[model samples]
Target: MGEKLIYMDHAATTYVKPQVVEAMLPFFTEKFGNASSIYTIGRESKKAIEESREKVSDAIGAQAREIFFTGSGTEADNWAIKGVAYANKSKGNHIITTNIEHHAVLHTCQYLENDGFEVTYLPVDENGLVTPQQVADAIKPNTILITIMFANNEIGTIQPIAEIGAIAKEKGIYFHTDAVQAIGNIAINVKDMNIDLMSMSAHKFYGPKGVGALYVRKGVKLVSFIHGGAQERGRRASTENIPAIVGFGKAIELATANLDEYNKKIMALRDRTIDEITKKIPFVKLNGHREKRLPGNVNLSFQFIEGESLLLMLDMKGIAASSGSACTSGSLDPSHVLLAIGLPHEIAHGSLRLTFGDENTDEDVNKLLEVLPVIVERLREMSPLYENVKRGNKNV
Candidate 1:
């Protein structure tokens, strides 16, 4: 706690930018009227919502009418999967998705399975990449949708989304990508990629939390995930979160406008940190693709130590990171994303996710590198597993 806190968990969420906050202020106070109302203030709020829609659509090359706002990325994901499934039940009853998907998509697929929809869980390669060929092979006549994440949240592996989308297009199946992590970090053209549906979150890119958008291609019929009012063109029913939506739009504008500069700076710092840690540490393995991954993502596993212990030690040093071993179930289950990429339970148990962001710098990386090895060594010294390896007693 003595060290200045270094936040390397941008993948979890990002701090809202000042510009975004400024843009949202009007919606929260002065222009605070329900978009559903017909009064002057309501009309103004409604107009702002539409403008935000257009900005989001233009950023992703989608039609403004096709953008549906939701409370969160998970909501959008559930809507896309279940909406397509229910809407196209007569056409098909099977959906295909990867095992590495976030719990939002994975759990929805599981729920669909219980409701009598067949689901094909595709596997990934050693680098956590799902191949288009595997997706193609998994398709059946009853396959109605394919939902794969654009980039893995934990491992930062970019999937072959374009290839998979093309295959789905050729086969007349809907393709949906949860691009929550990929939206700010990479360029996504829905039309160019032939994606039928895509989901994005605001908080992942310096926007306010609890606001997200789903892109549904024109002419794609889907049942409503939320049924009540005409908001989101009746696709989703809820009063528009005006302030958060405005903030989301501003955040996107800023992120895209400064994408190149941010990429260069963050990538440089991230790579330096990775290089330093790997060069100085023992038996460390880098997870995910080296070159084809996100600019600010660095995931690694240090053998002979538990991920929770490492995370706790890092916390003591005021280095904020995440480990795959921490779970909502309160069980030390290995991250499903890590295991899907072919890591053994022990290796996956030691996984660390260090996602960089705008505020990070070379000095921060140097500080992390300075403290990390000592922490790892201290933990390994108490680890019976490490002692056995050092003594040439290989038995577990």
Candidate 2:
């Protein structure tokens, strides 16, 4: 194994920042009081929760009252889709979304379909983009919601969110985006974008895991998700996870404050890695938009090699990366996002996703470039498909 570890899977989740940890430590022990209580320690906890809410709202151009904390991005997504569906079912039963959304969105939509909701799973172009026109055209009179992801977790393709949001607004439909992968990476204004609902995860942005938030625009009709307490302004119920919430707030504040510098540094490393890998490796295909992708995302497919093999090989070389979303890593199927963008089953099965972050340096990129080509070459040499092609077997 290589002496140093190179972590390049920020799209899955991020390590909690030290500053966020410091802010959260007090809530865990020193101020270990239930936020719902009315006593002194409880009041302090409540105050901390509200302050964190304000920080989250400020980071995303939302009103503090709009942010409701949840257990995870998956929970937020489930709530957003189901809440809007049930609340507005009398008016509409149709929801439109792209085919390449994360399983958090896709599976929720599927579950809604089982509950008698109609969904239009729109297809994306080869570059994994859904146009505003596709959204505008898919709208039916009964279309209650349009839920698309802000950015793809696998291929890292950013959607035309503003345009789609505007179309939904003009059509008088609610819009929701799973911004779990986009919260800290992209600048977003829910009001300006006409987004009625959005979901975010703390772990995606250097905050604690198991805590997330849903932004519900004022006056949007959404039924309560959890039903036990008066917490989250009666929208979501449960005792609040104050420590993680505080960490989330601190992390978002820091991330948005340093967004520009973070992008610049990470993008340089990403581009260099992409350029070097493609230049050095054979039969490589770059996934997602060449330009309109997340700054630190580098997705590629090496022909005649399995993505799992590549990932394991890279791991042995001290590079921690992913074949696709970490949530689906255990699955043997090819990435749905790659297939949505027209990649064949074989090529899609060979996809690799390496997302950069603030801590990744040029040395990390150099090490990857040096080790990756050798790994791919070695893997392909063992591949019968490449051997067949080498022997002029065109049918392969």
Off by over 4 Å in 1: 325-331, 393-396
Off by over 4 Å in 2: 393-396
- Give the backbone clash total of model 1: 0
In terms of lDDT, model 2 sits at 0.92
Q: On residues 1-396, what C-alpha lDDT tens digit does candidate 1 reach at each position?
A: 477999998998899988999999998888999999999999999999999998899899998999988999999999999999999999989999989898999999999999999999988888999889999999998899999999988888898888988999999999999999999999889999999999999999999999999999998879998888888777788788999999888888888877888899999987887898899997899999998899999999989889888888898988999884222324578888888888899988998899999999888888899889999999889888899888985544
TM-score of each: 0.97, 0.98
Identify the leading candidate in terms of lDDT: 2
CA lDDT, candidate 1, residue 12: 88
- Write model 2 residue lDDT over 1-396, tens digit each, in one string: 536888899998889889999999988888999988999999999999999999999988999999999999999999999999999999989999999999989999999999999999999999999999999999999999999999999888899999999999999999999999998999999988999999999999899999999999999999998999899888888999999999999999999998988898988988888888888877899999988899889999889999999999899989999999898999999998999999999999999999998998888888888888889889989988899888995546
The number of clashing residue pairs in each candidate reads: 0, 0
In model 1, pairs of residues that clash are none
